[model samples]
Target: MTFFLPFSTVARLRFGSASRIHIFALYRWNY
Candidate 1:
């Protein structure tokens, strides 16, 4: 399980950044 920790963290960071960019695009579209 120890080896899986870093993979999960990296996936979470990537997903977080993707969602942030998506939200930013939507906000720009609305305004």
Candidate 2:
């Protein structure tokens, strides 16, 4: 479990950033 924990966290962070960027772009067009 210890070995897989860090990898999961990093993957979550990367995915979160990508999603955040997409959301930002989507919101930009709302104006």
Candidate 3:
């Protein structure tokens, strides 16, 4: 999910602090 999205776009969405953490975790997992 997060792997398919660009970090800039994710940041712009501002899903929330918790979502940000989840997305960041996904990003780390993806890499």
Candidate 4:
């Protein structure tokens, strides 16, 4: 379980940044 902790944190950060980037692109596309 301890091993899963770091992996999950990294995954969450990556997904968070990816989603933000994706949202930025979509926002520009909409404009």
Candidate 5:
């Protein structure tokens, strides 16, 4: 479980940045 926790956190960090960029672009386009 501990190993899974680290992997999940890393995945979240990587994907989270991309997801934030996508969301930001969508928001900017709406404006």
Candidate 6:
């Protein structure tokens, strides 16, 4: 059997710590 979910990303995005913010900032800068 296989299972998948999408909300994990949102949860991580909202609840994620400084690392996510740093990465996201880097991503935004790269764009």
- Comparison by lDDT, 1 against 3, better one: 1
Kindly list the per-residue Cα lDDT of model 2 for residues 2-31, writing each as its tens digit.
Answer: 989999999999999999999999999896
Off by over 4 Å in 2: none
Clashes (backbone N, CA, C under 3 Å), per candidate, total: 0, 0, 0, 0, 0, 0
- Rank order (by TM-score, best first): 4, 1, 2, 5, 3, 6
Clashing residue pairs in candidate 3 are none
Model 6 per-residue lDDT tens digits across residues 9-31: 66676777767888999999999
Task: Please report the TM-score between candidate 5 and the true structure.
Answer: 0.56
Model 5, 1-31: lDDT tens digits are: 9899999999999999999999999999999
lDDT of 4 by residue, 4-25 (tens): 9999999999999999999999
Better of 3 and 4 by TM-score: 4
What is the Å distance of residue 20 in model 2 from its true position? 0.7
**Segments in model 6 whose C-alpha atoms lie over 4 Å from true places:** 1-16
Off by over 4 Å in 5: 1-9
C-alpha RMSD for every candidate: 0.9, 1.4, 11.7, 0.5, 1.7, 7.1
Candidate 3 lDDT, 1-31, residue by residue in tens: 6766787677667767768899999999999
Compared with the true structure, model 6 gives a TM-score of 0.47
lDDT of each: 0.99, 0.96, 0.81, 1.00, 0.98, 0.73
Model 4 ranges off by over 4 Å: none
Model 2 vs. true fold: TM: 0.64
Count steric clashes of candidate 1. Answer: 0
Which structure among the candidates has the greatest lDDT?
A: 4
Best prediction by TM-score: 4
